[model samples]
Target: MIDAAWLNPVIAFSIGILLSFKLRKISARVQSRRGPLIWLPDRWHDINRSKVLQPLYDIIKLFSKQTIIPSTATPFFIAGPILALMCAVLATLFVPVAGISFDYSFSLVVLFYLLMGEILFIIMGGISSASLFSAIGGVREIDLMLANEIPFILGTFALAITFDTLSIQQMMGFNILINPFAALAVLLSIIVKLHIKPFDIPEADTEIVNGLTTEYGGKLLGVLETARIIMVFVLIALFVDLFLWIPSSGALAWVIFLAGVIATGVLIGFMNSLFARFRIDQATRWLFKIPLLVSVLAIGWAVLWRYVL
Candidate 1:
């Protein structure tokens, strides 16, 4: 029997890979092209099925390549991706999936800090790489982080206030129905966190030569990519658990949870297709202004519902 302690990470990573395939397909369709092809045979009527395992293949290819660290980089350069991946995996442990969660008093708080640590390690890796582009990318990442952090925290705080608890498991309910405004605020914050279109300024390949990852390659880059894949799953799962009320146990619970994840992935992929990347200042201003206001309003509503009303 697989212990949940061992199973959760595998589940999270598998979901992440699946989401990546779906997102790629969505993006391709939006551009009027067929996306990844599955290995299974398509019917004679259907040609050009996109590769479902494309993301997995890409990661494997990266892993097979040789790593060449820059002569100027410090030992810490090697540690960055390692630490970032660790943080992402650690964060996944706290998130509930398929009605199973680690019972901790402050899982949400721990998740937030772990996510921050992931970002921090990425920044450190970029800066320590000693590449000019990487340094710029690291700086841009910091800028993006500063701009998004407050609203994200405020949005999450609204949820905490609404549930009157920081324990992730206890916070489960129909959160979207309870407070659509807070839910929207959090959804937007997550889009930024995922670095989707418009908010993808930190890694704008056109502007920064793939941004912080410009200097990363081979196995190091592979580790970072794996971390990103896992992060995608973790973040989406977090949102689903927080806002979408699925059954707490049984086979139905897993079905509902997976359906929610796919729905969220489709929505995000559509958004990514529709929007162009925002400039740093534009992205920061938008996040700080509208999302912040919505989050503040959410907090107020939570207060009213919990106390005055």
Candidate 2:
């Protein structure tokens, strides 16, 4: 039981790491060329003769590096990434993975609250960093929030309402028998919520080196990068619960679900690389209009299917 207790988080972290490596590979393949050669988790491991243990190399190199804070930046600047990462880890604790729940079933509600805290951390960390680019990134992040949040919330609410339960496991069980539209909403919202593509303008590289993360360096930056990647898996898992749910647990379900996520992410990234970032204002304007309408329509359709039909 103790091993079982630790297993879910370990798997979740491993999956998150694998996804980051996979994203690099997928992004490279999308550009029509082979990237680094394959190894245990990533093909990029064989880039040099020292490639066999590249994952270890990555961690050691990142963790041992210097964390630099700008001269003009406040004391909070040094601590912001750590705080954001802590919030991310705590949020993950609430997210049920691989049929494993936290200490109690009520942990689902805790997950929701923790997720909100992560968002708040992003806002605070970005603003407190004292960089012009970071501030702009913060504004764009908030704008992105305003644009897709309504759709996201309503989409989740639609699932919760239809299933009559906020617990992810219950929703997954219900999805197996009832509607597929909730699955559709989960897939679409994952893309938007992750800010994978066309929606990634908040941290557009052309405008901000790494968006709100421009100022962070060394290990601090690594934590933020890792957190972002972890979020990808977290969102993917949420989508899996909405769709591709299996009656009896099986590894195949996870495989199929992950494949779908990777495919969607690759497509989004390819599209993103092909186009220039839209102005922040333009992005929010379009997202608010199109996605919002689509979500409302989805909710209406789900209601009709459940009742008026």
Q: Which one wins on lDDT?
A: 1
Question: In model 1, which regions exceed 4 Å deviation?
Answer: 1-3, 39-50
Displacement of the residue 217 alpha carbon in candidate 1, Å: 0.6
The lDDT of each candidate is 0.86, 0.64
Q: Specify the highest-TM-score model's number.
A: 1
TM-score list, all predictions:
0.95, 0.84
Global lDDT of model 1: 0.86
lDDT of 1 by residue, 120-207 (tens): 9988988998888888888878888887777777777788887888998888766888888788888898898889998888888888
TM-score of 1: 0.95
- After TM-score superposition, the amount by which residue 132's alpha carbon in candidate 1 deviates from its true location, in angstroms, is 1.4
lDDT for model 2, on a 0 to 1 scale? Answer: 0.64
